[model samples]
Target chain A: MCRMCDWLGEGQIWYKNPKLHANRMYKLREPGRKPQESLRGNIVGSNLHEALEAKANGDLATFNRLIAEKNAADARKVGAQPIPLNEAIEVIKTLQMPVAAMMCICRKATRAEEETNLNEYSCLALGTGMFKWERWPERYRGGVEFLKPQDACDWLEYWDKRGMMHLIMEEGNDFLGGICNCDYPDCNPIRQRVDYGLDQQLVKGEYICEVDFKRCNGCGECLGRCHFNALKFEVTIDRPSIDPMVCFGCALCQTACNRGAINLVPRSAYPALRNVW
Target chain B: MNVVINPKITVDYERCTTPFDCKRCIRICPPAVFVVYDIESHRGYEVDKKQPGTYKMLPLYRDKCTGCMKCVEVCPVDALTVKMPEEMLT
Candidate 1:
């Protein structure tokens, strides 16, 4: 955030002459004219079938963790270094890579097409905790002066040793490998309209992050943190009204769960709004 | 030059937030005046060119106008209120 603030402080938000009354040029291209960006899918350069089978058979457990382990291992074998996440973020912005959630593994996430049935799993990490990673001390040690191009590769190298830095998917694909991780929400090939608040999800959410009703301790830590006006006391079925449109999927609610009641499951982004994709 | 929408002047709309980085407000204005940007929205105030050349005033005033509301019919979101030394409303 500090670095982003610095970038913002430099008066650079793609939009020129942001001040009111200033006549500036419009750079937003039409949808078709917009650059070609593929959505991410569960397509890594690894054996996804076995991984999924293990998950289905209760051997691997959550698909997210398995995908991370595999990607980390492969990244290490190929000598991919951890580019300072902050620097990597900067590079993604500079180079304009098409990614979602900064940490999207290339092939595990993508856009939902109007046609074609896909067994693919597209998940974005939406990890707010990683902001702490961006502020990690070691990343800024080199300073931009020494943040050379080679250092970019070294950054990926460092990344290979860690856990899945972004959203990971364990599945199949046709083009663009099974791993698309990095940044650039619009073009990251790993994100979709829903990842960056572009889908029909602008309406109120239905399936909100919830806790096991049985495990409710009645603590209200999550109430203040919730940006949306959802969340209710546990008494009847009125637990929390999840307005998905407002939920950025930051998972702070789950983090605050003292009784392990908050669990994120597939729920309607909004009830009234029809799914466009 | 600055595009002044005097609080007394007429503007098309209070403002328009065209989403993402839509500089529609800038494109519509005649003067190459700078619009201020809000800290979060990244849209708003610009230079008060009527005075000494420097950044001043509500730096984030632009984000306030969403280019919607009825006010836009008269005051365009691109409208600016330039305060000349003499015309400066005390």
Candidate 2:
């Protein structure tokens, strides 16, 4: 991954870049049959179905353009039945407006190369939290507000097999208003998680509220930050003891410790996150 | 020729959290064989091809599959699959 360029979602227009291995790279450098292994596993379908699937994969740009041209001949408008491919692109562009407005987008993982169609190489997209809404034009209704954490877990599960899902940091995303789905090219959180190099840029929710033995002001400032009830002042040491399981890694208590007492220690990988396939 | 749900496409009901958010099969398919109801959860349910209930899970969409394996590869919980379709190839 291009560490500095990753901060930008576009990632320096790396169509010819050699590093990307999973998607485009492995397909290119490996011998014909070996490279085609991923593609060959595809199931067959009708012509119309193939055409539509091709567009979603962004594999058939000319076919999509042709369909768009044909739809224009039919003369349709927004919200009309069977929204034209061009309008679908418009809807995707519309969802992207927020990222466009904030300029908050970033590039995470890398692609080997996409064959340019009509001489325009495709710009990849990725997003997390509320940012996912902009990435999928077809999924416009923001219903994540009505969903729970398990719902988010299931949603991620759906994309995991296809290699399309990722997680967002608690600091950058709050589920109440955060997005539920993400695109490979439109999400930063997913991109960073999947990058082959450099894990530092991704935040680990470490450095939480562990009490220092020396400072026992008994002010209970740390207690106030402990929403999970993990911290309670023992009184004798002038510091709080923590209940680890109750501490869901919120990191809020770390912010409350004035004497720089509370510290979060690293542990094994998060149990809930292990299902991140 | 003979069709059985690929053994690899096992659905974990515990993880499914069904009737959940997205009918991802609908979204991912080129021509969606599965009709996902936004309001209902299809978690842990199986499609009986013989009876063929009105609330149907998608068939293989086998006809439309390009052998892409993208579907099989991307399943979060291994809810879908594609295997060696022996008859036609041989």
Candidate 3:
């Protein structure tokens, strides 16, 4: 379980519980206060877009300035926490409410050419948020199809098996927004955090991967599954070595390993990495 | 937003004979600037004894291109060419 879930998943995972979410939503909107209005405030996305433009033009000064500003802005705003796949599954199954699959907006924007033929319905929105989804027409584009808990689990597992990282987000800083099935190259949060040195959008998972050399066969399967570039084969040792610092604790490597040599040790166990996120 | 940078990616369509079969640029690009676009009529590439519908690569998010050139480096067929901005050249 992730630190966020461990701290928040008491009687009911704080965000998924309908009553708590309703309270949060009411607080956010509060009887006609500009409709709560995205809470994202527009700066983060705009700064990021500008930063990308700068980076593309090879304007290091501009890119660095924009990225720093964006990071600073993200640091001030409280937001979603990254949970491991297991915790994500637990949250979805326990919600006991309607879950819906929607097209991945990131994939659609970046990989437009592949949109027509690809099944980009990898983002899962949970809780009662679906009931009034029409309120946010932009988010509900192409509409949402309901999924049974079992089907939801299957869908999440399918994405996990395909090496997608599961990210549980808090909408408007409080509501359990949804779970995004993300990939390294296309997912904005992942790309920004991993490649651009921004850590505010998503926190690290609560566990870290450790490989036991004794029972290990260096088949190199787990190496490819790591999006953080944390896993690599030590050519001399002919075994996979994981860099703890770079590991997001997503445990995709553990799932990929057929040898059972990989384990997800609680991040708390390693004092140095406990607050690394 | 008409933004700071727009990368020029030239795809040698004639040389890019079988793009779907060889999506090096699409797979390797970190920014995901390249994507597969469907060509209605099946004009190229054969699969399972049939000419499957052809797909072409397009630089969909040209503004997002960071000029890392992973696509250029990865394309085995040498069909992709990238021209970074002058500022980027420095």
Candidate 4:
């Protein structure tokens, strides 16, 4: 287990703890309470937008200042944790709550750019959030459907096949709220953290991917699967090289590799990346 | 709470076809202002069954719209009419 599983994991590897996420729907489902975003998700999205705008305007001073303030502010907000898709499914099975797939507003805003019948139902809202979702009519517009845990797993696996990484989010850092299956540029959190140089809300996964070069073929398939720009093709080795500091340990590369050459080691195992995140 | 901007987009339900097939407007709006609305039920695609006025595009995020008009340009049915916020025109 990595430091996250050690610190937040609370001896149960965080995601494995039922009590850490027990009756989330019960607590969040009070009548007429506003559907709210976790402070971190809200702040990071807006901060990244502003910072990017600043950079676009060639205002490096403003961009640097904004990023610094946002970073400090992020440390104080509630956490928006990033768990690998495989572990996220395990968390879903443990929670055993009703799951509903929702349209991804981030992708709708960023990548899809408009609306298309792309059939990309990439966001998963869990627990009471799914029930009281109508409280936020604007967000629940595309609609949501309940899924059996098994079906949810299958759906996520399908997205995985399509190269999406999953991250579980806690609304306001209290209630277990969503499972966002996302890719680069389209995902608000990933885009902010990766492109904006403002790393606050989203944390890296507990593990980092390591490549065993002996069995590896230099096919370069895993390079595109990485959203974090962690994977690179080493010209000398002619194989994929992973920069552990930049890796999120989502293991999309491992799954993408047909040769079984990649593996995830606990991030804590490396002194450099252990405290980097 | 989510914020909405000033946008007035109307769709010619009679001409536009999303329930049975086409969804160009829904696919093209950047702010996701357009959602599939069931006129007969006054609800959205949240329901399982498709109704008679099963799929007409409605402006759900009219406030979030930046008046890009990409949807207006992309709609094949020529069913969408968009009004920009007055301030945007200025």
Candidate 5:
């Protein structure tokens, strides 16, 4: 289990808990207190040029200090954890708040691609935040499409079939906000973690995928689905091997497997991986 | 220790008036280092991208830049400039 589970799970995985989603729907503002800025807004305002410059100049101390400072400040803000498709649907089914399918901001920012059509929206916005998304025009451009729980599940399945990893995002401390269906360098959080070694922004899931060699064939269908490079085809054995440590438990490879050779087991089952997150 | 150098990217907002309409820098950069965003949107309201100067290009992830110069070459107005440190030439 991850630290989020320890803090907000209330004896269950944090994302799986319905109460967290319910509480985040409408946070009552304290009387006479100013409203805080959103995490995405804060991220946009932050200047990472100095840290990147230090990194370029081979100044490890300065780079580490700057990154650490930024991470510490963002520790209480938005963060995400990869969740399997079924669990993601389960979260949607259980939540009472509105679920809206919105254009992926990461895709727009990283690739300059726009999902103008309703069917093309790849990100799901949870809770009441979707109601007032017009406030953040840059982030919520092209508007949003509200979905029924059943439709949301089907939409999640569609993205799963398309080989996108499902990640549940926390808006504030212990407040569940959205579900992101994205992959690789195109996804901001994934890119930050994989390319820049910024792990705090996203954590591994509650499960780890394992390969069932008995039913396996070297079809190589599942190899390309892995964004983390955790799955490697063993040429000698003619089977795919999974590096348990590298797997985020998104189950994209598992879904892609035609032979049903891949299975996800609880991370707690392995003592070494129990606290890896 | 081996010395490393990175490209310093700058976009002259004056030379580049309409960034939303012309996204050459955003599209050409292989690393997707450049982002075109609305300046007024930060103030908590939507701004029309059709209005010139409302949107601007920013090199948000300069660390990821490989000094490819693709963005600079692709810029129609020649507003982008990528300069490497002089130490790298020594």
Candidate 6:
């Protein structure tokens, strides 16, 4: 289990715990007091560039310090972990608050694609954060479209089918605030972790995918769906082998397999992968 | 020891108007180096993007820049410039 599960899991996976999803919609505060600061304020941006510069200059100390600082900041602020489609649906089903579909901030920042319509929004904002989205106009560019529980599940399924990974986002200390449907490069957390080594910002899921060689045809359909580089075509074996260490357990490949040759096994089932996250 | 020099990327905000509306640099860049954000909203409050000069685009990930000049070429207002230092040329 990861550190979050140890802290908030209550003997289970943390995201699966419903307590994190229960956030107070309105807090009583003194007059003239500002609202609780948004999660964006807690983000320590651009430190990765400085860390890279330090590494390039052979200043290992500075590089290590910057990375450690960024890790700490990320732990305190926003963080995400990949989840499979069924688990994401389970999360939505347990939500007591409204689910709103909002334009993906990462896509806007990285691709400059404005998702103004309800059909275009790729991220789901949870709990009280949706109520105060106006605080971050740049992120909530086209506003949000609140969806029913079934509609939200359909949205998740649509993105899952489109090859986007589902990631549960933690806004503050244990508050599950958003579900990001995105891919590598465009998704900030994934890009930061994969490219720049900001590992703490995005953690792996509790499960790992296992491929069934008996049912494999080596069609190479599942290889393209993996953003983690965990899946690769093996010519010698005539089928793709999944590297459990690199898999984030998004299950995009599992869904892509037309023959149902892939299955998700709990990470704890493998002794070596138990602590990999 | 080899000295590493990063490509310098500058966005002339004065010349670039409506960065939200005209995200040519953000869209064209292969590595997605540019990030268009509202500076005023850093403290967490709404800012009107319709208002002129509300949003500013920055090459936040300059390390990822390959010095391809794709952003520079695509920029309609000539607001972006990527220059590799003399050390890198050698």
Per-residue lDDT for A78-155 in model 5, tens only? 568899998999988887678999888888766666687678999998887778877764677667899998999999
Candidate 3 lDDT, tens digit per residue, A1-277? 3434443445443444544454354343445423323434555564765666566666879978887877777765544555567778888766566688876766644454232211557888876767776667444654577888888888888888998988877765456778898877777678778766677677777678999998788888887888889999999999999999888888888878898889888777887886777
* Cα lDDT, model 2, residue A69: 47
Q: Quick one: how many clashes does candidate 2 have?
A: 37
Chain A of candidate 4: what's the TM-score? 0.85
**DockQ of prediction 6:** 0.34
Report DockQ per prediction, comma-separated.
0.01, 0.03, 0.16, 0.07, 0.39, 0.34
- For model 6, how does the per-residue alpha-carbon lDDT over A3-66 read when each residue is reduced to its tens digit? 7776667678888877543434223344554443454445667577688777645577897799
lDDT of 1 by residue, A103-129 (tens): 222221111111111112222211122
Candidate 2 lDDT, tens digit per residue, A66-122?
444433332211100111122223323333312211111221111111122212112
Query: Top DockQ: which candidate number?
Result: 5
The candidate 3 chain B region of ten consecutive residues with least summed lDDT is: B41-50
Greater lDDT among 4 and 5 belongs to 5
Q: Which residue ranges in model 1 land beyond 4 Å of their true spot?
A: A1-208, A232-241, A244-246, A268-277, B1-90
Using Cα atoms with residue i matched to residue i, what is each candidate's TM-score against the true structure? Answer: 0.27, 0.25, 0.70, 0.69, 0.85, 0.85
Q: How does the DockQ of candidate 3 come out?
A: 0.16
Q: Looking at the true structure's interface, with contacts defined as alpha carbon pairs within 8 Å between chains A and B, what fraction does model 3 recover?
A: 0.27
Off by over 4 Å in 3: A1-45, A56-58, A113-120, B1-31, B34-82, B85-90
Q: Per-residue lDDT tens digits of candidate 6, residues B1-90? A: 434546777778888867888887787878777887765754444455667798888777766777788888888889888898766668
Q: Give lDDT tens digits, candidate 2, residues B3-82.
A: 22221222343443331233354446553333322223233232222232222233322333445566556557666665
Higher-ranked by DockQ: 2 or 3: 3
Q: How would you encode candidate 4's per-residue C-alpha lDDT over B1-90 as one tens digit per residue?
A: 322244566778776755324556666666555555344543332433233455455564354567788988987778888886566688
Error of 4 at B52 (Å): 24
CAPRI quality of model 3: incorrect
lDDT of every predicted structure (CA atoms): 0.31, 0.34, 0.69, 0.69, 0.79, 0.80
The CAPRI quality class of candidate 6 comes to: acceptable
